[model samples]
Target: MKKVIKIAGILFVLLLCAAYFLPAVQSYSHIPGEIYILKGSSKTIDLGLPVKADVDSSGVVNISGETLEKGALMQSPLVIKPLNYGKATIELSIFGIPVKTVRVNVTESLTVIPGGQSIGVALDTRGALVVGITGVQVSDGKVENPAREAGMLPGDVIIRANGIEIQNAKQLMKIINETQGTLALKLDRNGRTIDIFVNPVHDPSDGKMRLGVWVRDNTAGVGTLTFIIPDTRQYGGLGHAITDLDTGSVLSVREGEIYFSEVIQINKGESGIPGEIKGFFSNSSGHMGNIEKNTEFGIYGKVFDDVDLSAFGEPIQVASRDEIKTGPAQILSTVDNEGVKAFSCQILRLNDQREPEQKGIVLQITDKELLEKTGGIIQGMSGSPIIQNGKLVGAVTHVFVNDPSKGYGLYADFMLGMLD
Candidate 1:
């Protein structure tokens, strides 16, 4: 009888051990590695586990309710109060065992007017982008691919040739046509610099020297505007980077512009077929802003003084990732001749992202009007502002090709960080 009691005690201790460690393992995915809080403001976060938090720098931030009772299965709230504009680290532990460390940044609160108007983006790449490699016919009736022979790929950006910086496809062509022998070329391949020597072949058809490579220097498209900062007049749109359709490489911005556009047509989306919004904007007038940077997050620039701000309404508060929850939301977008309108949607999933990511929110369109108009989220709807609980939470990023009603969104906090 004593042996049986001893064995039962051992089993109970093992069960308690599993309960303690199970939440510790799950905390890694629920808590972010870094978080930003507004200065002088307090934020309460629930990690779904009872844990203790310790701050490394007391001057920057302070933690309230630092300890939670052990053996409690319910989620515990940790209140973070930012004291100043600086940085600090918070270490989370369970029963004196450290589980995760989160970097906390105290920054000034920012508010911006959410934009849903359709805008035209005209971006000129920093250098000519090679889109394709083909064979060049020589005078001897033989074909040679000089670009491939020189180890050049389709996605390579020819930045310099023969010690001259190349700005456009026409300029690169001029340099190749004038070159006599093997030309030294500098290329930007996936952010890495490489130098190669390529022998230009004289094409019998055009009677001009050719590298047997197709290059493009500019790209243009229509997209919804995300937000506009009132203080700096800076604007962010697209919610994601613009890539070349042929090479699938992110376009490096040299100079670009955004213009006011009007939605002329909308092709309804269908299963396996992504629709698009067609709009027209004049290059001479309707200028809204200048594109300064094209990053993985989106395109950012300063807006012109003449930009119409009355259409976007008043500026709204921006919500951090932790502040966002899965529930009903609304997205501001322009689909037809009418101006921006709010459409109902639902936040299906929210990802706890430690690093910057584009697809952090999975959402589904639920508005019967929107579902009937565009057949759900379509192309050119990217960067549509998502409003939840009266706060700007995120923007539309991408659509699930298989399901037109479902799409991905990016956190507004990540987009705002790019402004800094």
Candidate 2:
């Protein structure tokens, strides 16, 4: 009896060992011994997030047994897994053998910016970014005034006041109020960004350190690109002044520069009030060609930096200004990506011999893209260049409150008139 029992025990142990070599068991599965892994696609890990994700490595291992196949010593998911962002590796022992190696990646922490992507459209990897200004004007002063005597010019846009960075108008005021000494001014003159020192005089009534000069940051707003001259390559647009509706006075040209601004925000049109394109401009200045004198036209200036890219270079051809009729046209402005977005509109009037301030042509939006994005012409898009019948025609200046898209344009020549 003892010998018989010993033989049975030996047989059972051998059978169990055989099952361990057999594949993982499944209800109606053919393959057994192969190790299987269940995983999902990699995910992005946003900033400030802790790591934890589901990798379904949940399966049972069946071992070959003497009398019948039986459950293995352990199943998966029993192995502890560590989670990371990009790629994670986990190790586990299967059936007392160091066999399976699992790899997982943390995808949640990635932002794939195209190789040569331009920051004019994209935010940083961490996102939530603001365009930095190299310099800007905060206040203005009268010509040959006390501020001027202190070396401050009328067009001197203040970059800093009292040794503090001047971001915007409000912040400039805050610094001026806090500083109780002679305030120094930093400025950008005629494309040369420089710091100019000046002291502020105390305002007796307000008891504040005040630089009597009216200061302004660099002028940044949306302006349409009018037509690109055939041989000159100079462009033109809005001829009038863009003033902060609040202050009736004209906005100073202290900082004579243009930037690529986008129409990010919008105030919809209503019964009485109309919609507008709300955008912000940065320190990135394009060609500082010419500022047109015709309020109805655009100025021509040489771009400070050369744009060889197709998006900004190589003017698209349009037949004679005469060929352009009252029909569809596209407006190129940077309210979104700083690239040209087309909007359909009717050519209200195409005047070849337009007035000094009147653009050679006039058009209205009939396309859906402009309507959806800008709700017709808004403030910032005033100098946006207009393209019609393949030729650079003019820029949008004013919007017909009644028909927002149906605004006026300054003739391309009028803008060119400002250039030497």
Candidate 3:
């Protein structure tokens, strides 16, 4: 009986192992992996495990066929070289168990001139954003919050005030002051349209009518340029959206412009405090581009003629996420009067993100000059190109406030995908 019990226990342990590994393998197999590459380019894809992988081409793609390393433990990546534009499927199996399938897309080579210069961005929001709600002094000494009573919250966008559409803060206030009864308010919250009514109170301090809500119409800041498609003269920058500081809501873009900015000072970053590059933008200066889309990935715009790209040299191919490796890397960023300069950094981690995000690559500043001057990645450095293995891999997006030397980056391919 004891011997029988020992055998059962062994079987139970094996069952437990299979229970965990099987689901993981099955789920990962359906996750859908995709790689985008230019024709005549070869990219190595690491499976992160030992597997026997096979490439099945749809015949639409022109290739010498897929070259894979097979062994008792196939630890190496499956190297694929696309000779022409086409599509293919890469299937992997672990000990005869199907593991995962990767979709390969080969397209025409795209070259873009990378921009690292600091540029000033001025954006007009779609409508006035309700950033905050405060108390308004009524006729007597009592103060009341009208917006709060109407169930309005921060991050809610005021689409229309009363019967007129609200374009800016001034316009919203004008309509509110002109009405005396419960003002009809139309709000947009996370894409849903909501309507509420708020009674305006007379602010005795200002001698004007008020709703006690703080609204913002426009936002301006400085950021590094990412890349420019020379053919269309279209550009992308910031590798992230321009979000409101107080409510942390991404501002809707009604209209915007990108202008050349001159970096005058650098506020060095340190632990717990992020630094910034103070740049001055004068209206007299030529506008670089007109912003068209403001997305979570970054801002997209079309460039005019006045923008300069001679300093950045020739265009470089954008590297896909699978091509990104953890090793030595450098970033092109502007620090002083020298314009955009390459600074040494180390790629520490790479996240296998399947969606658009700003934290695809983790890096640390290793250059002595950059560390001494800026302490690490500073503000206004977003959209700085991250070059690795002589290719544009990603862009600097955010800095770790606690660890000034470390920061996050967005994959260059992600930004390129957004342009279309």
Candidate 4:
């Protein structure tokens, strides 16, 4: 019995050791397929083993050692620094065994003037978005849902009405009100364009023609400006896409505008209840820019001459994900009418994202003023520029509902890639 017990204890110890070391080696084996490195920047990667850095293009990259050096440290991280602007491949090997191949893209030193001023985003959808369909009361007191009868469903985009292109909800309403009989609607249902016929009902309550469908053509909200490219006079904001309030679908933007805004109130955040920063758009000739694209990485467009970028100070070079570390950082956000202020934050987590994702970095608000006022990140704080080590690393995105102090951020590399 003593022998058996001793053997069991030995086996348990071996299993525990394997459990700790196996996953670490497995995770280390899984390096990013592609890594973006800015010119003259360095990235450190720990693979849990000695690695020989072999750069295909010597002109673009500089390895730590010679071609026949043993490797990076057995347990230490490998430091790969970019020397010039070009593409190269860094082959990492352990004792001549190729373990991983990283496509190193040494890009130009891209810089942007960080923006924190709150800008009112007024987006006009390409077509009216159908949110819901309900029964409409006619003159005879009969309730009818014409849109539903025509197979029209929520999430459908109405593009045309009575052979005319419908740009907004008001235009669709006007045609319906003036139509003598049945109306033809060209709709885009999940990208399948089709036409549907529905007869409008004259409501007794207001004597207006009704389709019994709730549709919206425009949306407006406030968000912090992320950056403005000096050479292009273009800017981007709201690291994540602008989703509809009802259906939660990404809105397809036709055209939009940015206006100057000021925060009026702040709803303190708590666990499970997200907070918001309410602001009013200024109609005082503060037209700042025009939005042209609405992508998963936010909105991008041209800026007007009236927009004052002097408040942003100087342009900062962007940082790739390879350069982001889990440590101290700061975010530029406008929580009030006082303009942009830098708030300290800590990067708690960094995700391995080969593709574009909004939650590339997780950060916690550590600024006393921001915490005291908003209780962490709030709505309208999206697009706040995240700076780390004097580089623009990302932009603030969604706040965690269970922890308002923590929120997601999009890597600046992803946002800058969308400019073209």
Q: Best candidate, lDDT-wise?
A: 1
Model 1 scores what on Cα lDDT?
Answer: 0.88
lDDT at position 311, candidate 2: 49
TM-score of each: 0.88, 0.44, 0.82, 0.81
Q: What is the C-alpha RMSD of each candidate to the true structure, in Å?
A: 4.1, 24.6, 6.1, 5.6
Runs off by more than 4 Å, candidate 3: 1-35, 40-88, 94-96, 308-312
Cα lDDT tens digits, model 3, 195-230, are 999998988877788888898999999999988888
Clashing pairs in 1: none
Give the per-residue lDDT of model 2 (tens digit) for 1-420.
999999999999999976754443221132121121222222221211111222333222111111112213333223322232233333334434444444432222111100111111111111001122222223343222336546654444455566665566677778767766666666654345666555555554556555555544433355555544444545444445543332232333423544455456777554345676665545553433334332324334433335533345454543323335677777665556545555566777866463365545667777676677656766656666566665655566677777676678765435545666
In candidate 3, how many Å is residue 266 off?
1.2
Q: Give the C-alpha miss distance for residue 70 in model 2, angstroms.
A: 99
* Deviation from native of the Cα of residue 22 in model 4, angstroms: 11
- For model 1, give the 10-residue run with minimal summed lDDT: 65-74
**Which candidate, 2 or 3, would have the higher TM-score against the true structure?**
3
Model 1, 82: alpha-carbon shift in Å? Answer: 1.7
lDDT string, candidate 4, 55-103, tens digits = 6676676665342233343335666677678877777665676768888
Ranking of models by TM-score: 1, 3, 4, 2
Winning candidate number (TM-score): 1
Whole-model lDDT, model 4: 0.85
